[model samples]
Target: MNILILGSGGREHCLAWKLSQSKKINNIFAIPGNAGIAQIAECTALPINKDNFPSILEFIKNNNIDFTIVGPEAPLVEGITDYLEGNGHAVFGPSKDAAKIEGSKVFTKKFAVRNNIPGAKAYFFKKNDYEKAKEFIEGLDAASYPWVIKADGLASGKGVLICNSRHELLEALKDFFIENLFGKSGEEIIIEEFIEGFELSIMCICDGKRIIPMEPAQDYKRIFDNDKGKNTGGMGSFSPLPFVDNVLQKKILERIIFPTFESLKKEGIIYKGILYGGIIIKDNEPYLLEYNCRFGDPETQVVLPRLDNDLLELLVNAGTGNLGSTELAWSAKKCVCVVIASKGYPETFSKGDIIYGIKDYSNKSDTLVFHAGTSMDKGNIVTNGGRVLNIVSQDKTFNGAIEKNYNKIKNINFDGMQYRNDIARKVAEK
Candidate 1:
């Protein structure tokens, strides 16, 4: 079957890589794919924007694309799945209605409360209610100093901020509501009670009813090491968290994942495709941090490598809502992915710097260099976006996998290249 994937990041590149391993797949194509994805699949200049829906449909018909997978949230929020499904195309994504769980933080926060889902307590504020929001924030107890201000809409994972003092909180609120830093995404804001705990990411395949959870992953969100800098898309990730054993896993599935689906079902939304739960584990209990409608970026770079199943068939089955008796198997090995970004990432940074050593390093066994933001520039690969490449490595042990990746990362370099040195140190040490 010919497969078409949307988006141009590392997650889509990893999806393209995993899907290519399936015998059922004939040819794979990515819309506006990056330099690394072009090595494995046919990269087309086809735009996947909502306005170009007709063009995508035409390409689907002409290319005999048997299935399509969406790798980003923007097109999905614009009703890509609804549009594609209405036109008799099977798509691996949630409908716009279901995608609102990610698109609108205010909607999802209220829905979670109404459904009794376990998550952080949040107070939603509109753009015009800055005073009321300020009053509410000021009234909070002293322990609530560190508040989380989140833009109700998507901001490429940079919309959430953790403030340590009332001064910082007010500044963040000003940035969102007063200064309009996030634009439409900040039109509505959510001030959530900050909770301190290590974060966990769970990606599951859902067919409206049943949810088949994949390996657990932990992603570093901050742009700098030691989690000290502002949040970026993602800095690095590792799969099969050592701390999440069978007991904690069962607790999460029962208390979080299963109930979340049941609540969505009660709302009459039939969710199809990936459902990502960002959780914070405190005192051995998992609390829902947030949700992503699709796969996580660096998380996918690590998690997909551990999958021992035919990803193509599974996604197709999930899209059709038939995923009957299809159990996914995963490798016992551990995986790690360290994102290589342009200097001053998650902010203004120079691009078009020539990158080298990727081709030579990726030739190693159990190692892959998935491109996130790279383009071919005059016969040389150059930095094209904030996060440029994911150096992925797999091994029987997590530490070994991390070491292998770092060893390989040493050889890869570009102008203003930056990456976290402690990708899996916390988990590996524990």
Candidate 2:
């Protein structure tokens, strides 16, 4: 079958890589794919947006693509699935209505409240509610030091900010309202009481009726090690969390995942794609941090490697509402993905620096390199975006995987390269 994957990031590259391995697949394609994806799939340079939907559809039709997998939230939030499906194309993603679970933080927060889904206590504010928001923040107790301020709309995973003090919160509000840093995306905002806990990314395939949960993955969002500094898309990720035993897994599935699917159903929304829950576990209780309509980056890099099932079949089944009879299989081995970014990522940095060492490890059985922000410059791969590449390694133990990635990463380098040193250090130490 001919398949088309949308977006240009590590997640899309990982999807292309996984789908390319399926013997049933006749051809694989990516829209605005990066260097790594181009190696294995036909990379179509088309902008993935609402205005470009027609062009994308034309390409799909021209290529006789059987299935299209969405790899990012932007196009999904913009209603690409609805458009494609309207034109008689098969797509593996939620409709625009269901994508509100990620598109609008305010919408998700209210939906959670209506569904009794556990989450952070939040205060919603409009762009015009600047003074009102400030007044509310000023009256808050000093004890609640770290508040999470988020833009209602998508901001490429950079919309959420952790303000540790009243002063910082006000500044963040200014950035949203006054400075218009996020523009229309920040027209509405959510300020929530910070939930203290470790974050887990749970990605489940929902076929409008049944939900098939993948192995849990833990990702480091902060650009610096020790969970410090600004948040990038994701710095690194590891699968099969050591902390998530059977009890915790059951709790997550029962309390968070099930209710989420039911809530979407209650809204008359038949979600048919990946329902990614950004969950925070506090005292062994799962709180819904957020919901991503599609798969999680870096998390996908690790999770897909641990998947023993054919990715193409799973996605096709989910898209066609045939997942009720589907069961997932996972490898016993652990996987780790360490992201290599530009020196000054999550902000601004240079690009077009040649990358090396990929050829040496690309053929290895235990290692795989998935490109994110990369491009071909004069026949040499160079940096193109902030989160550039994902260095993935698999092993029987987390320690082995972590060590393998770090050791192999030494060979691949570009100017102004930066990555987290402690991806799964805590788990490995245990």
Q: Write the per-residue lDDT of candidate 2 for residues 1-430, one digit (tens) a residue.
A: 9999998999988898888888799999889899888888899798998999999999999999999999889899999999999999999999999898899989999989888888999889998889999999999888978999999999888899989999999999999999999999999999998988888989999888889899999999888989898877889999889889999899888988898898789889899899999999999898999999999998999999888889999899889888768788889988999999986788896788898877434534798889999999998999999999899999998899999999988988888899999988888845
The lDDT, on a scale of 0 to 1, for candidate 1 is 0.89
Instruction: Report the alpha-carbon TM-score of model 2 versus the true structure.
Output: 0.97
Error of 2 at 59 (Å): 0.5
- Candidate 1, residues 1-430, lDDT tens digits: the string is 9999999999998999899889898999889899888887888887778899989999889999989999999999999999999999999999999999899989888887887778888888899999999998788887767889999998977788888988888889999988999999999999998887878999999988788999889999888889888778899999888888999998888888888888899889999889999888888888888888999998998888889988998899999998888888989888999999997787776689999897543333788889999988898888999999998988888888889889988888899999999998876744
Candidate 1: residue 195 Cα off by (Å) = 1.0
lDDT of each: 0.89, 0.90
Model 1 pairs in collision: none
For every candidate, C-alpha RMSD to the true structure in Å: 1.6, 1.4
Least accurate 10 contiguous residues by lDDT in model 1: 358-367
